[model samples]
Target chain A: MLELKEGVRHPVDFILNGKPARGLAEPRMLLSDFLRQELGCAEIHVGCEHGVCGACTVLIDGIPARSCLTLAVQTAGRTVETVRSLAAEDGALSDLQEAFRRHHALQCGYCTPGILMSAEQFLRERADPSEQEVREMLSGHICRCTGYVGIVEAILETARSRAGAR
Target chain B: MKPKPFTYLRPADINEALQALARIGEDARILAGGQSLLPMMNFRLAQARALIDISRLAPLAYIRKTAGEIEIGAATTQAQLLAWPQLGDATPLLSAALPHVGHFQTRSRGTVCGSIAHSDPASELPLCLATLEGKVVLRSSKGERVLPAAEFQTGMLATARRPDEVVVAVRFPERKQGAGYAFMEMAQRHGDFAICAVAAVVSGKTTRLGVGGVADKPTVREWSGLPNGELDDALNDFAWELGGTDDHHATAAYRRELVRRLGRRAIEEAAKCSS
Candidate 1:
């Protein structure tokens, strides 16, 4: 059993994006803060701090979850993927990101990273999804800008293009 | 806002988790999905001197079906239940209501037992449990005991579970032959909390109705046989018995009316399925 005392910083090791990352986190520290502050992962945006907002959404072991609702200590030895993982190796945007750009899927870009992370996993799990299914998945996120029309189009177009490529 | 400082304990197994709970007692809280507990901690609404995280306990993550009941381990996530192939056939009410519990993201990490432990009046899982008359299995260092859903959930945000006991699993009765089930809820947003939720189980002449988000806790009432007018009157009386109160989300009268309307719809649909 691992016991970390309160009011003290403990080392938490995890796989960030794909590389190994370690951060010092107090027992009370949330995974969202630990990723952004301790590990210098600025891509994780903090919105409501509670689980309601999707701004802090990330993939823990390839499953999308709310980082704000997760404790930093809980991610020990687990793989945590942020929006940064969606980009290509040479700084080129992935197909989904490219689709978002073409469809004007984002307005303020605050909720884009979380939405992209969620969409990446959603598409991976379901290669061919109906518009209703896509909307249901997107319901986890709250996008105040773009009215969600562009975001939906971007995801559907990405699914269609990806299917065509396959 | 961050949680208050507290010790973090990751138990190796269920036994270790139970022992720690026995040692820490009321000062400790079991962290199983963290979908609800974390939010309360972040908002400073709840404080724990220690958090025993059972999420990593591989032994506690399972869904077992034996005889006519489905037993969900403490660590089993809601997503796992939804993805189970037998979900639709084993317990159709859970299938219809699980999607409305939370969004895809939250469900991926939220545990069924954790939601029950939280005992939120607006939550769908407890409502389903009440409607199904499920059992909550609690274990401690001393021994184990099981309580019915109605007995386990004392009131909103409260349960009858002792401080030293850990909810190991929950058992829900499987689908009965020739029975039909339906769940319906009214929430402002898709993933938001329900303003009023209803679960109906229609089998033969007996009809069970469980209502949530209208009272302090989910309440279930059964009617054996009643004419259409009598059933409406009975539902109206049940609604009044619940004493629905005005909240920021809805008015008392609006919620009572929903009970009369949605209750009828759910019962009718379930009856259709059974027929």
Candidate 2:
């Protein structure tokens, strides 16, 4: 049996939602596994188990990473955010989430969380990205449902609405 | 499939990384981005007895211009390299080739050193590094040694790195002012591995061409100035030089044809950059 939390433990101390927590984990454990199994964040799904599928996406230091491919120990001192943290304490969706709903971006919803996380990072980095840029940036993700028209529309709509508000 | 049971070690610095590697020796594998290693582990293709995680070493992740060369930390991610401004002026070939890597997510974690060490014939980084005559900085408990790109890659999925040595960084000579570069590859999918890839860097009279995915290792050829009717000859030379095998993706004959066609196009494109 493989020890998931034993052996030479690397101390992972990082902030999640303005709170700091530390954990001891094996270096080989993936971040996705750590989040789901250790931290009890089941919202972060393991998709392809490879870097190709973005279903394991999460924000590391505000950048999207395939948590499946990222070692848990690598997140030792970094900030990590999953889809579960996107909403407020009362469960109100953010503007991006609202836009996703309004644009009918999700289908079966299996790929939604990853797409949302990637889009959130994309929007944060590029407040006014072109349609092509959006497509290129989201190419890392794979969605078996809704093709991708809905996701693109959602992101663009959210950007426009936010631009108008600003 | 989870990685086979292995002792995991996280070294805080380069010296520690090297020492851990030395202590673990041949049964160990160094984990960088884990973009490639993890997938291979999932498939059970790689079964390392120990994993040396080098992600914590932050100093080995910068790209800077020094004297007449561009020094890139082995841990530099593809996204970082693509966004690097100096790459556009110092090594445009690498800048052009960066996007062809796996994708944004993989690029975000995949390191240049890791890719080079992986030495996948279909990967873009190895071809670019080989064509540029890049140098790899490898460190061990014994000392440090720099290996040129040509000598660094031994064969398919093989490198010159010793079991105890960790790749520290990669350095490329600054491109000549009038030099031009072009990289081209064909794949069924945009982010998929290339069936055949070509990289060309033309400086003044000498044009260097590196072809990958058609050989055990990246094959490089140089042409002094432009020779009349030499393009076809050079293409034939490269095609003959490449001893590719029939694989699931493409047949040996098909790969040879691609090398010829892509080689001609790359040469033509690179010729335009020659002064």
Candidate 3:
């Protein structure tokens, strides 16, 4: 049997929210734990350590991923984005964030960050996304409050608004 | 729950990974996407004394097609395969079923072979593999061998692979020309495991029907000749014969009923698409 040795810590250096960050994590440390406990970024919540709950979703190299399932060291040299990155440099809310607020898409707010992250990426990848597409994208995320009516509306409105801007 | 402490080794290539597996033996588990293993570990359902991190094996990340088949490397992510422009044309069944495996997020990190290797009875990829008659390539220090997807997966979370061997790639031989495809699943929620899922590839004279979540492993039953009355009754009766057990998510009887309903719907859906 392979032995578990002591004193193993891998160095992880990466770009987070457009800022450089570094940390040392055991091989088993989850990225969600690294973000919340080590970096003190609490916005990314962990509802189920399993992949079923999308609460721990984040952007790895700009792709939406469940941070709870990813190892901390796996983010090495990659760009990581969280709900915190959705705001503008001047502190203005991004279009999607503003849309969420306008539509009251969130209640309890635990699932909001992950939803916002997933929605933002969904919009970024596809231009002029249909309402059905938006709903399909949100299927990965669960919202206890609002029953996803406002959340889906907000994303659809954001897509329309973004299309007008373009 | 945190996984029991285990040493981690990131091998740069497949040879190194095989060597590490041989050295570590049963104590080590291959860390691919970790979409399944991490959850199992966190829930204390799976424990490993060590992990061979093969995510860095760049050579194993590829999607190539020959004249008659599509080959996907072990390190290929589910999302990557989904996004490939040619995938829908080459393997319509896979393209149709990939989105149902999990959410887009989990799919982003989940590897092709990893999903195939996990062999979850309710998993979409395995059902597609079985329906399409795919092949799984496994390699270890003892050398490499190829097994049909039907032979590769033995049972729920069980496979024919020896502990030392790792599934290296999956090959989907080309489907019959002008085959129609449909994938349908009845999950509690979107992205949830299907209570019962079905995939069908229908040509003018032959139809391959695959069912999941009604048994310990996905089952593929093929029929020759166009859809007939006997097919529906036979399928419903056949579904009852699957090794289903009552669990919290569903009852064995409920699963059988789902198999009957979803199976008919899937066949209809496939029949509609046959060009």
Candidate 4:
């Protein structure tokens, strides 16, 4: 919705999904908009647009953040990971994503991408997280569908599986 | 869903940022995290001709404990502070209150001084600062001034900061050992703006209580071990003195009750902290 205007733009170069991606982004353009429109990363869903919804969340420099609230230029020299980065090289699901599928963690799926990114980061930080701990980490994410029951189960299962593998 | 067009300037240094801010004056807004500012801009609630981006100004991203206070640089992200174990020991109230600020995503980019400067009545950071008698450092091309948190936040979404001055950092007066503290809030959801919240520090028999969302600015007061039993009478006399009015989140009458109940609970919990 912002490209129609002639305004100041900045050339952004960053690592997106293990690949170099460069684009000219306006100052007023949000990272969510840049990822969706310019980089063609459509997994970032923008709900409520006000940052309340976790639909547009992404990993900036390996930390989950609301891309809708981050400007495109802010990622000028950083690494960004979208939900698309969760798949294996052969397109098989990551352990976390498989758990999500096995547990039926999503319903409408609009909030799935953001939740997956958030859970992935949480799991990375905490190799063995309790069910309560998982809930607390996920409290920041809002999952309207599934009542957060299946999502919680999925992350817990993944954490258990990872610990068991060790 | 889009912000109005504006020019963006990423100053390489703090002095350069200060100079540009002084030159642009009210026309420019400092971009720190953009959690609140961007959302406001998207809703057309705020507009600026220019935005001075300071999120990456390395000099302003620091947390230092000096003398008896913790100095937090303006660009210090909430996530960074939350990860600091030393801060957890020094300012337990801050660590306890941080998780309630926003979800993990917002906290990842939200800045401490940004939250202080935002000065939302229901925000947990402001409530913690007010309860701790913290100070905010305001800097400009001319000079710098330090203001106590109580004096810095003038009203809802308003502060004592001049247009040319940027909130360089915030200073939290370090608490002594055995000062038990707790933060409690009633939000509609986990990450939503709190309808009413309270921060309390219980040191022996005395207590310091700060209530948010019930006033234009958070209300802080040092009290004796007993509760403020005169709340009903006090409301009649100082309704305007409090921070909140009748808003959509909660009615004034209901908020007053929360202040009474939550304030008591916070003090009780703080007393249980053991240190």
Off by over 4 Å in 1: none
Highest lDDT model number: 1
lDDT string, candidate 2, B28-127, tens digits: 8888888899889876899888778777578988998999898888778888988887777788788778888988778888998899989998999999
Candidate 2, residue B229: lDDT: 75
DockQ of 1: 0.90
- Decoy 1 TM-score against native: 0.99
Candidate ranking under lDDT, highest first, comes to 1, 3, 4, 2
CAPRI tier of model 1: high
Of candidate 2 chain B, the 10-residue stretch with the lowest lDDT total is B1-10
lDDT of 3 at A57: 92
Ranking by TM-score: 1, 3, 4, 2
Q: What local lDDT score does residue B131 receive in model 1, on the 0 to 100 scale?
A: 95
- Name the regions of candidate 2 deviating beyond 4 angstroms: A1-12, A22-24, B225-228
All DockQ scores: 0.90, 0.38, 0.54, 0.47
For candidate 4, give the DockQ: 0.47
* RMSD in order of candidates: 0.8, 2.8, 2.1, 3.0
Candidate 3 lDDT over A4-51, as tens digits, reads 243477778999999999988887888999999889999989988887
On residues B11-108, what C-alpha lDDT tens digit does candidate 1 reach at each position? 88888888888888999999999999999998999999999999988888999998899999999999999999999999999999999988999999
Per-residue error (Å), model 3, residue A98: 0.8
Backbone clash pairs for candidate 3 read none
Number of clashing pairs per prediction, in order: 0, 0, 0, 5
Question: In candidate 4, what are the lDDT values of residues A38-90, reduced to their tens digit?
Answer: 98888889987778877888899999988888888778889999989999888
